[model samples]
Target: MPHHDGEQNGRGLSFAKRIYLPRTIGLSVGSVCVAVALYPLPWMHWIWAMLVMHAWVWPHLAYQRARRSSNPYKAELQNMLGDSFAGGIWVALMGFSALPSVAILAMMAMQNIAANGLRLLWQGLLANLLGAVLGFVLFTPQIQLASTPEEIYACLPLLVIYPAFIGWMGYKVALKLSEHKHVLSRLSRTDSLTGLINHGTWKDLLQVEFTRSQTLNRACCVALIDIDHFKTINDRYGHIVGDSVLKALSQALRDNIRASDLAGRYGGDELCVILPNTDLDLAVGILERLRQIVENQVDALLPELRISLSIGVAPYEQHIVDAASWLNEADKALYGAKSTGRNRVVSAPCTRADFQGLALGV
Candidate 1:
């Protein structure tokens, strides 16, 4: 069967620095405690060396291997498995002493779950079992089921502090991932150029707005607004100045519209708005005011640069069968406005009976 080790390539550096390092340190410290629990045995000196190597040296070696590997994620996962094996070896060295053995197993299980849930836990457990068998062949564990009070005390600090520390670390990781997810979601929906909603997100919202309008028999309006002579602006003043003009327009739209209104950049130079439960006349009045505000703002801010708007307003009619038809009607009005005068607002003349070709897109 295939396994889902914690080899998520996207988690690369953060996973190592935040999670793996701390786990290594915990395992190392806990190993020493288990080693000390086996105190003054004939093999205790060798066990001390092993503890130092596993605790002090192994973490750095694992980090280096993970960092240098072509697939860092996969390498880190392998390192975790190695950690389990090391843990098993220590458990046997302690003669399977109750306090320290249970501590090692619990801590290892916690680390596995934190890394990638249950699958990795099982894999780590298997590694532990195999390593235990190896340790039995090599050293022949004394199988001390009950621990002396001294051994129990030695195991206490690691058991208490390590879990608390790891728990705090887990909490921090959760918060960071949550924040990252929110940022990614916003980036996906927003236009980079203008801070308005992007084309695809706006279209998705339009469908929802269309459904609300249709099912409730509500009056809803869509306005398609285009920047007049944008090409001329770019030609005369260059793209940077053109960008300033778009930013200015975007700001104006943001300031003028209500929070309930949906404003988005449809494509280059063309911005659209969805006005729910509003009539054509009301929308026109609103757009006309917006037109004046935008023109005056641009004039006040950048007097040398002159720019204007052409806006089209179309009410969502009961006869309009689909989202495409609603958008088309508004688009037609925008074209009409552009044709009549560069700076004006026009309404779609009438709903069309010829909805065959376009209706399929609904």
Candidate 2:
């Protein structure tokens, strides 16, 4: 789909050129054998003129026609029909020599399929048939029954080389498709601004970590982090500089987090981390370092502006019912940090009673 851009149908015209050129060469080469096996053309100049145009010139013509047309894809389809028509005409002129005629028709059908699959193949087949009728009218119907050794020898190159060429083309296209799929998969999970896992992907991982901790009976902490006075930063320095701050913070997260830890852009200026096999004290220590990292940083682009973070640490407890509750506890701790003073880490109390004292103690 990426290849198909700029006025939809125009998208695959280059693709059409790829289809056109090789088939043209193969058919042109095959024609020598067909001509020898059948009648020597009385219209020698005419035949050679058509052959040269098809072999040497048609690919460029087809590309230009498609590129210049309002509907390039549709124009290219017409070109494919032209190919089938020419193939049929050649078959008739060769008086239907069995091997050569069948070879030409089969190659036409394959070219049709490569351009637009079975439906287009059927259309090209009809075009070939119509051209055969025209050729019969113009040149008279005749069928050759035998091929000489020389004629057969001439056909050998096309038979051997053409199919191998098509197969190699197919292999390369498949590799490109695989690479595109990998890029799409990465983009779907990543935040464009921070280059961190997006909120939805991070939330999905949070649920998984929560379940893993419950099942394995391991300690884990979830931290919710928010940039302090982010709106003020945006207002004073504008969004471009604010974006730089987010990028810098993302770089810090990338640098500080261990392989086992997962950090993500939760939403806007908020970030979240899932630290498995880590308890409240360790989580607090990690968040404190991160808070320091954010606070001490000055924008490389706007050196006068500085940034800080309010972070909340909540360890998994036996009483926690679900992932949402665990995240809510961390959010409450984050709120505590923000409300008390920015640029600090607050750990949520295990129970409701200890909250006022312990949370504020941060």
Model 1 residue 131 lDDT score: 88
Return the TM-score for candidate 1, rounded to 2 decimals.
0.75
Q: After superposition, how far is residue 254 of candidate 1 from its true place, in Å?
A: 1.5
RMSD of each: 6.8, 3.6
lDDT of all predictions? 0.83, 0.81
Q: Tell me which residue pairs clash in candidate 2.
A: none
Which stretches of model 2 miss by more than 4 angstroms? 1-6, 9-12, 32-45, 146-153, 277-282, 300-304, 317-319, 348-353, 358-362
Query: How well is each residue in 225-285 modelled by candidate 2, as lDDT tens digits?
Result: 8999999989988998889889889989888888889989998899989999998899889
lDDT of 2 at 328: 93
**Residue-wise lDDT of candidate 1 within 1-362, one digit each (tens)?**
12333445445655666665676669667866776677745675667777788888888888887877766777888888999998888788778888888888889888888887899899999999988889988999777778888787878888887888888988887998899999999999999999999999999999999999999999889999999999999998899988888988988998888888999999999999999989888999989999998777636555788768999889999999999999999988887676665688888754333222233343
Q: Which candidate wins on lDDT? A: 1
